[model samples]
Target: MPEITYLEGIRLGLQRLMRERPEVVLYGEDVGAFGGAFKVTLGLQEEFGKDRVFDTPISESAILGSAVGMATQGLRPVVELQFVDFGMTAVHHLLNNAATTHYRTGIPVPMTVRAPCGGGFGGGPFHSEELESLFCLMPGLKVVYPAFPSDARGLIYSSVMDPNPVVFLENKYLYRHVKEIVPQSFEPVPLGAARVCRAGRDAVVLTYGAMVHEALRAAEQLASDGGYEVMVVDLRTLKPYDADTVLTAVAATNRVLIAHEGWRTNGFGAELSALVADRAFHLLDAPVRRVAAPDVPVPFAPELENAYRPNADKIATALLELMEY
Candidate 1:
């Protein structure tokens, strides 16, 4: 058991997996010699050599196309998109080919495509985008977004071992900022599962990624200064979400607040809101509130960017409004 940052934990997990499975290989634009844009694969090339840990061309579609073929042929290929925003070029390959392969031919597409996502890095529009909503709509894809370091490591390992295609989104903001102790024998946290980060009986904040920190901060402020108790539930996986855990939390709290980094309209938050309204309608005392980025591209300016994305203050204000309602 060792305390590690989210980035370190993922690095450790990937390193371990590479050792355990000879068939497992990693490829991205700069993963080999450059060690990845975020350094997640730092030193991987030196350890595994360029034959296994190599770099791909700039085209995302090619990277995915190569991975899909390799994975279907019994090789575990972990391909990294430099950023989530860049994944648009490979939509046809991912949404249609990789996602539907299992149903199309009854064959498993055991591939893990990792994308560094979210804002707060001054990465502007092209580099920062929560692109989960696009693929969540596509059937046969396992979309996972982990908020904590341990979850990130465990889920990525599980994704590598899964028989179906998995899209692993890593929050760029949490990569270096968040850290936690990982068990030496870290068991994979089941997919479609949610973690109750904090428990409260008054109101609930359902969220993931960097917003998980924001929601917890908001909850703490509410308890200390506002005297309002707020429960925090981290939806670790977006698609195949743990409705049971969410409903249970909603039943106890009677109020819900959905949060994410994506735009407010037609975003993942809407999906979550619908689920709670449909399944836990009778248990709620107030309408489900959503705290998300504005319906606009991520801005390059610091001040404008701050307003574009959701944060602790915004979440706290929204929770207070829900409490009053």
Candidate 2:
């Protein structure tokens, strides 16, 4: 095992997959020569060649449309949207075409759309955003949001191999900052599974992506300073989120706090809260609380950006209040 940044792990996984499968083709803006805006695809163009690894125009809709056509024609295309915010420009292809092709025609579109998501880099409204909830609403889509370097590598590999149109949401905020030692061998984590990052008996924190790290931090602070045990649940896959694992933790902890980088209203956190209330209401000692971004566009100012994103301190404060209630 070697310590690697989250982006490096993804690069390794893609490289391994491309070597293993000839059908795997990657295309996106600056993916070839520039190695992507975040350098996740650095050195890939030289290895895979221009035919297999190429650049695309600046249209997100065109990129997604091309992926759909390629997938249907027997090519496993991995399309990258430079930023998640640009996904709005191609909502039709994502919502109607990529997501419904399987249901409408009984064909497996083995394609992946990887996009840099979340706020923290002061990327402002146009560059940073989380649109997982938008695609999660579609029945045939698989949504993956991984927090750690190892999980990011594993989940992205799985998404590339999956039969459905999977949206791999990479928290750009974690790309260079989050580090972990990953095994050389690439393993694919199955979709719809949740991992309990930390165990506790007082309260449970249901979260995913970069928020998982924040939740773990809050759990640590709660134990060290507040004497509260916070169970941290990381839902690696958002679309078919692990309900059983979530309920089990909620039952044991009795209190739940759902957290994510997405907005509070109609966000993934709200959906998780609904899932807990629907199936595990009897086990809850207190009402489920959601910690998420404020309902507004991401701000360009550094201070406002910090206020918009949920952090360890905010998560810890919410957990403490929920425990008291």
Candidate 3:
């Protein structure tokens, strides 16, 4: 009902959830007073007050550790990492404590770590990385990475409301760059569901976050020029990924391509490939292909970073290979 940027969607979701639920609190560096690094929380502090929306110290470990404590004590805390790469600082808290809290005991840790991820603006190695799989692989965590502005709003609402630790990956590339008409309501987009962004039959491309746009572009070009109808499947939630949807696509297309901006080696694409191979191998007319960033750190220079990340061109090339295979 309203056109908004990805960042605005996040802000709207936070605003709606905070208004509905008093237990929802936001904590991150410069979140209060300063209003976050990207100003997603610009007016949150003013609306919710400093107690409910406050800034945290520089240490990510401390931010998450405190969130764990608050969550165990019945507060629904939503913490933010300025960048996803910095999440490594609190890996112990994410991987061990926040993750295992409910599984080990009966107490639910309703907390969320919102991390802005991906790089198309030269954030370099220190700031750019898509560690979705890194967190999705962890059993006790729910990892959500939405590509569209509307899904960004819906998923953020769902993640914050869930009674478990959720890693909400916000693509920096999509934050201000992408915009669309979003729903007026704050309905939650259920996690663990796959969205078929485009319908096709020749091949299927499985991806999420910013890469989902690339896959759609590739699908368009493939249809226009190559006459190859490529179905684009967006795995909105990575942790409890939609396996049935993915396998159905693989079975129908008989050709699949897994793409992401993360490093090719051990990237989330690998998991999708494995799933297809294991479950839908008989239906595959060609081997499952993958298009991902090379095994290297995100570069500082724009030109190098452009090459470092996967793009629509690369995705189309991979699709052609899979289609012709």
Candidate 4:
């Protein structure tokens, strides 16, 4: 199989789906003629035409409201918010209308909101923020964040096919940088599945999205320098996270480290930490460690941002402490 960029893998999946499923439509700002801000939808407008794939106004609320309305009418809309940060602007429509429509009317509001997230590559405050925990907290929303190119391609298709509202978080940093041999025929990597990227026995690191690579780096460093085997868990989905996988990894390793690019306080790591504490506390040999960005606004300065973000060195440092404890 030929290798494809992570961004191209997403385009391939959407292109195949749009061609195969007439009900699938693309809606977002600059998605049609402009091919999206990141150019992930480039040339799609020409193939799918303006009707099936088109742009929308700058209002996130309007984009979400329109998707919900279309989903009810039996259209599976793939909505895009340019940046995850702007998703906050449309919280009302997403959390209240689309998320709760099924429970109120017993209907499947099948739609997926795609947004580029994470803070590496100096995207700054507005373009950088990771809001996984915010949507993960909502009862009706299913959040899926994939790290690898294969996962990126597969999860996008599954999210479109899902019955409820799904927030498909794409890391901007992984868009062009990451590449893998995605199968020629797209396959759906089911939601709520946990992939163990690298297996180990001394410690388990639970992570997703852009942070998965960082966690892997930490695992390598610990294994090479510290002589400690580390288990790295890539949570492809967030809201319906794989607790069974997490417990198993924690049980075998006896040490846990949860990390993410999102802020530490009230971040998704906090939720994962609490889950392990509640159910797998007895299996832990040390207090679960969390490595995350400080609870502050994302900075524009590259140097400051580097310090603000948690990377391999930082994660390894925390893991070493956990190993000692």
Cα RMSDs of all predictions?
Answer: 1.0, 0.9, 0.9, 0.9
Q: For candidate 3, lDDT tens digit of each residue in 1-325? A: 7899999999999999999999999999999979999999999999999999998789999999999999999899999999989889788998899999888997999999999999988799988888888997888999999998899999999999999999999999899988998668867899999999899999999999999999999999999998988999999999989999999898888888999999988889999888887888899898888999999988989999988999999999889888777
**1 against 2, candidate with superior lDDT:** 1
For each candidate in the order shown, give its overall lDDT on alpha carbons: 0.91, 0.90, 0.92, 0.91
Candidate 1 lDDT, tens digit per residue, 1-325?
6888889878887998999999999999999989899999999999999999999889899999888999899899999999989989888998889998989899899999999999997999999899888889999999999999889888889888888888999999999999897677778778889999998989999998899999999999999987888999999988888989998999899999998988988999999899998999998898999999999989999999998989999999999999999
Residues 195-287, candidate 4, lDDT per residue (tens digit)?
Answer: 999999999999998889999988999888989999999999998999999999998999999989999999999989999999999998999
Residue 45, candidate 4: C-alpha displacement in angstroms? 1.1
What's the best-to-worst order under lDDT?
A: 3, 4, 1, 2
Error of 2 at 308 (Å): 1.4
Number of colliding residue pairs in each model: 0, 0, 0, 0
Candidate 2 residue 116 C-alpha distance from true site, Å:
0.4
In angstroms, give how far residue 119 of model 2 lies from its true place.
0.8
List residue ranges in candidate 3 displaced over 4 A. Answer: none
Pairs clashing in candidate 4? none
lDDT of 2 by residue, 37-128 (tens): 89999999999899999998898889999999999999999989999888888979978999889899998899999989988987899888
Candidate 3 at 297: error in angstroms?
A: 1.0
